[model samples]
Target: MTILTASAPRDEMSGAPDVRVVAVPAGHPYVQRVTDAAGIALLPDPPVPGAAEGVWWPPVALDPDWIRANGDRADVLHVHFGTESFAAGHLTACVEAAHAAGWVVVFTVHDLTHPQLVDQRPYAAQLDELVPCADALITLTTGAAAEVRERWGREAVVLPHPAILREGASPTVVALSEDLRVGMHLKDLRPGTDGPESARTLVAAVERLREQGRHAVAEIRMHRSVRDEIARDEVRAAVAGHPYAVLVEQGRLPDAALNAALGGLDVCVLPYRYGSHSGWLELCWDLGVPVAAPDVGHFSDQHDDASTASFHPGDVDTLTEALHALLSRHEAARPGSIARAEIIEARRAHRREQDAATATAHAALYRRLRSERAS
Candidate 1:
C-alpha cells in the first residue's frame, strides 16, 4: 500500500517513491537509513546545525507556509525528539497544521532528560504537552517506552537503537594488545546542577586503575561541543596525580575516524551517574567491545544476560574490580570475551529486526490514517 511521508527536502535519496517523507532540518546517524529502508522520499527542510549534538532545535523555523506546502503531500509526518525542539505554542500549531492537512503525526522521544533533570519544570511540561499530540510515539528502549506511558498516558513503540555492525567480523575474538587501552566518550564533564555526579567518580576510578598498573594507557575522548575550559580544568584537577590518564578533545570526528578510534580501543567504559538510556552503550555492543558500566537505571537492560559486567557508580573499589576482571579476562583469552562477543552480535541482530518492524509498523500507521481520511 502507498503511504505519504513528509520530511525536509534532501537529494541524498534518488527517485521519489510511493511514500512521502518530510526530512527534518537535522539528520541523526540512522535517519537516512531508516527513511531509505522504508522507501520514503525526502522533503528537505532548511539547513539546521547541531542536529547530532543533542541540541534538538532546528535552525529553520517550522512555519505555516512550510507545513502547508509539505504537509499536504504526506499522509504522515515522522519527527525525532520532538520534545527537545518544539515549544508548547509552536508544537500545538504544528500538530494542528498537520491535522488540518489530513496527516498523522509520529514522534520519537529519545530522552525525557537524564533522571536527574526530571524535575525541570519547563522540560517536563513541554513533554507532557507534546505527548498527547502525537498519533504514535516511538522510544529507543522498552524501559523508556514504559516511562512515557506511565508518566503521560501515551503508548509508545519500543525499538532498540540501530546497531553499528562492522564488516568482515563474526563476533570473533579481538585480541587484546599487550598495552591495555581504554576509551570513554563523555559529552559533558559537568552536567548542570541536576546532571549526573558520576564524572568525578569516573575520573577517580581511572586513577585507581592506573595505580594498579592494569590500565597502563587510557584515552578519555571528550566531545568539544559539550566540553568547556572550566570542565577541562576540573578533569585535569581530578586526575592530576595519574600520569597515564590522557584527555583527548575530539571536537567532532567524521564517522570513519570515530569508528577507527573505537575499533582501536581494548575496552569501552561508561560511568553514568544516572540516565534514562544510552545510545553509546548500543554503539559499544555493536562494536563487540566488552562494556563496563555502573549499575544504574536502564544500563543493566542493555547488557546481554550472559555477557555484561556492572559496578557501583561512585564506588572506586567496585569500579576497579570490574576493570581488573575485564582486563584479566581479555589477557587470558577467557571464554567470557567470546561469550560477550556473541551477546554483542545478538544485540545487533535484534536491533536490525526491531528497526525493520518499526518501519513496517509506522507504514501501517500511515496507511490507516489515509484510509480514515478517505472514509
Candidate 2:
C-alpha cells in the first residue's frame, strides 16, 4: 500500500469553518442527523451500483489501500459501523495507514459486541486492533463508555444520539390506530436475533389478552434474506402454528411504509440477542411509540423515559410481562390524552437539546484533535 508519509493532518482543522470527515458510511440516517449543521462535513462514500439500502455498503473507506491512496481527502476518519467488513490484521493496517497519512482516526464504539455474528472472538480481535489506536472514542451512553474504558483502557466521550424525527414533525406521519398492535419486526432477523423467540412470546401475550377479551394482536413482520432464511422460516412456522398471530409482510416496505408500520403499533419489541446500543429504539422514541427491549448492552442506559421498558433477554415470561406493563401504561393515556402528548413533546424537546449538545461536542473534539497534530 502507498502510505502517505506525512505526520500532521491528525485531525481536521487549520482554523477552517468546518471539519471534513470521511465517515465510513456517511449516508446512514444516524450519521446524517448528528452531523447535520455540526460544522462537520462528511465526505460521501464511494458510489456503488444498484445498492439496496440507498446508501453505500461495505464502505470502501474501511479498506487499508483506500486509506493509503486517498487519506488526504478528509481531515478525520470517523468510523461508526461496518467493522464486520475487515479482519484484525486488515483493520490494523487501515489505522496505521491513517496515522502515516496524517489523518485523525475517530472510532465510535457503537457495538462492543457484533450483532451479526454468533462468535465474539473474531470481532474482539478487530476491536483489539482498532480501539487502542483510535485518537478519540465515542459511545452513546455512559454505561457503554464505562465498559469501553474497562475493556479497551480508553476514555470514550458519552454523546446522546440525536433525534431521527425532528421536533414539530407532522403528527399525520403515523395514522392513528386503536387496537393494541404489538409489533415484532424480524426483517432478515438481523442475523443475531431473538425475534423468533420474541414472536412466540408475543403470540402468548396476545393469547392471554384475547382470553381477557382485549383488542390485542401479535403482529409479526418479516421479509426473507439470504442471511436470515432459517430465522425467517422458523418465525413463519411459529406463526403458522398460531391462528391469532398475523404476519404483516414477506417483502420489505419502503421507508415511509416502514415508519408507518412502526407508528401504527402500540408496542414494539426489541429482540436483540446481544450487542450495544440501537438505532431502532431511537427511531421508535422519535415516533412517540412505546418499546419493550431486551436487557442487553447499554439499552437500559440510553434514555430515561417511561415509554421504554426492559425485559430479560431470552426470557419469554419477562418479555411477556414487559409487554403487559408497557401496554397497560400506553392504554392509560389515550383518547385525546394530554399525558401522551406531553411525553411525546418532552422526548422531542430533550432530543432538541441533545442534538445541539452532540453537535457541539463532536465539533470541539475534532478541533482539539486537529490542533494537537498541527502543534
Candidate 3:
C-alpha cells in the first residue's frame, strides 16, 4: 500500500523543467505496469500511418521525424520495444534525433537477442548504436548486466521484470491425481521456439511415462500457421495414435482463454532452441506453474532450481529425463493436502511483492538518473 512519487529533476541549463518521457511502444504491458507504479508521466506513441488499423507498422517511435516533432512534449526518450522492425541505420537516426532535441535516452535492454529475429547481427548492430548513446541503460537480470559489460563495455542498471499476473488472482489448482498434464505452447512459433521437434520429444516422453504407469499427457498448442502447414506434419503424426497426447490447432488465444489454459495445466514447458530472457517464464512464475525450460538462456534463473527443470534443447534423452523428473517429483508431493495448497498460495504472494519492489527500484533508478543528468 505504499504510494511512490517521483518529482521531475530540475534542468541545470533551463532551470525548472517538465519531465515527460516518450516510451517507444508505450502500450506494452510491461512498460505500462512499471510506469504506472513509477509515478512518471508518459507521452503516448502516435498511431503509425498507412498501416494496419490496430497494428503500429513502422512505428512512430522508430521515426526520427516523429521524435523531432514531439521533442517539446518529452524531456527523455525511453525506448523499449518496437525497434526490431526498424533498420539499424534508422534506429541510430531515431536515437540521434532524440539527442538533437536535447532529450536524454533511457534504453532498457529487454532482449539481448530479439525474440523474432533468427539473425543476430542486425539486432547487435542496433544495440551497438543505442547502448553507448543512452544516458542510462537498464536490464532485467544480473546475468544480462554482466553480458552487457563484457560485450558492450557498459555497466547497466539491473532491475527485475515486473510481474505480469494481476494481484489477488490466484491460479486455479487442479486436484493432483495420477493423470498429469504438460503443455508446450507454440503461439506463432517465434524464431527461437522449435515447436515441431519439441512437441515430438514431449509426446514421446509422455508415452514413456504412461508405459511406466505414471499416467501423463502431453499437449501441443499451435496456431493455424503451424498446424495447417505440412512442415509441422510431424507434430500431427506424433499425436495421431496417442489418446493422451493431443495436438490442439487453434488461433492465437485471447488473454482470458490463455490464462485459463495456463492455469489448468500442471506444468508448462518452454521449447525454445535459442533466445534471451522470457516474459513467458515470468508469467509461469506468477501463475505458480512449474516450468521445464531449455538451458539456453536465463529462464531458469527466475526460479529456484527445485521449481524449474532444465534440459538442453535438441537433446531428446535429456529432455525426456527432465520431464520424467518433473512428473515424479510432483507425484511424490502429497497432492490435495492443505499444506501443499498453502505453499502454492504463499509463492504467489511472494511474486506479487517482488513485482512491486521491482517497480519501486526502477522508479528510484529513474529519479537517480534524472538527478545525475541535472547535476
In the predicted model 3, the residue pairs found to clash are none
Candidate 2: regions farther than 4 A off: 1-18, 48-55, 166-178, 210-214, 224-226, 241-243, 334-342
Residue 59 lDDT in candidate 2: 79
**TM-score of predicted model 1?**
0.75
Best by lDDT: 2
**Candidate 3 lDDT by residue in tens digits, 1-375:** 222345434442344323566787777778877666434566676787776665654567667898898777876788888777877688778878987887778898988888787898888898998888888888877778888999989988766777777766655555756667788888777787787788887887777777777768887888887522654676678778888888888988876677667766667889788876888888766665677899876776656547679888867677777877776665543334454466557766776676676666556566666568667
Cα miss at 244, model 1 (Å)?
Answer: 3.8
lDDT of 2 by residue, 165-271 (tens): 74456244443456677888877777567767777777877887777677777888877553666666777777896766788656777766676677667888887
Candidates in order have lDDT scores of 0.60, 0.76, 0.73
Candidate numbers, best TM-score first, in rank order: 3, 2, 1
lDDT of 2 at 66: 88
What are the per-model numbers of colliding residue pairs?
A: 15, 0, 0
TM-score pick, better of 1 and 2: 2
Better of 1 and 3 by TM-score: 3
Q: 1 or 2, which is superior by lDDT?
A: 2
